[model samples]
Target: MRTIMVKVKPNASEAKIISENGNELVVAVAAPAENNKNPLMRVFEL
Candidate 1:
């Protein structure tokens, strides 16, 4: 398995991977941070 660093932005208009550089990524999710159980998992799913 490979390891990657993810930065999550909750409550976005859509879910997507915004930027990726090497092992780091910036992710945006539509679900609200408070309501969503696992935003990081959601990001991974996307």
Candidate 2:
């Protein structure tokens, strides 16, 4: 298994992944930070 870091940006325009470089993975989510409603489902959908 390859371990990587996920960077989530809440309340953005749309849910999307910025990039994956080195040991870091940058992503943008449409859901807000409240109630843990972040759009994490699309993270591993890549």
Candidate 1 residue pairs that clash: none
Model 2 backbone overlap count: 0
How many clashing pairs in candidate 1? 0
lDDT of 1 by residue, 2-40 (tens): 334454556777767777766556655576778766656
Candidate 2: give the clashing pairs: none
Whole-model lDDT per candidate = 0.58, 0.54
Judged by lDDT against the true structure, how good is candidate 2? 0.54
> How much does each candidate deviate from the true structure in C-alpha RMSD?
4.8, 5.1
Tens-digit lDDT track of model 2 for 1-46: 3334344456567866677776556665555678455445333333
How does candidate 1 score on lDDT? 0.58
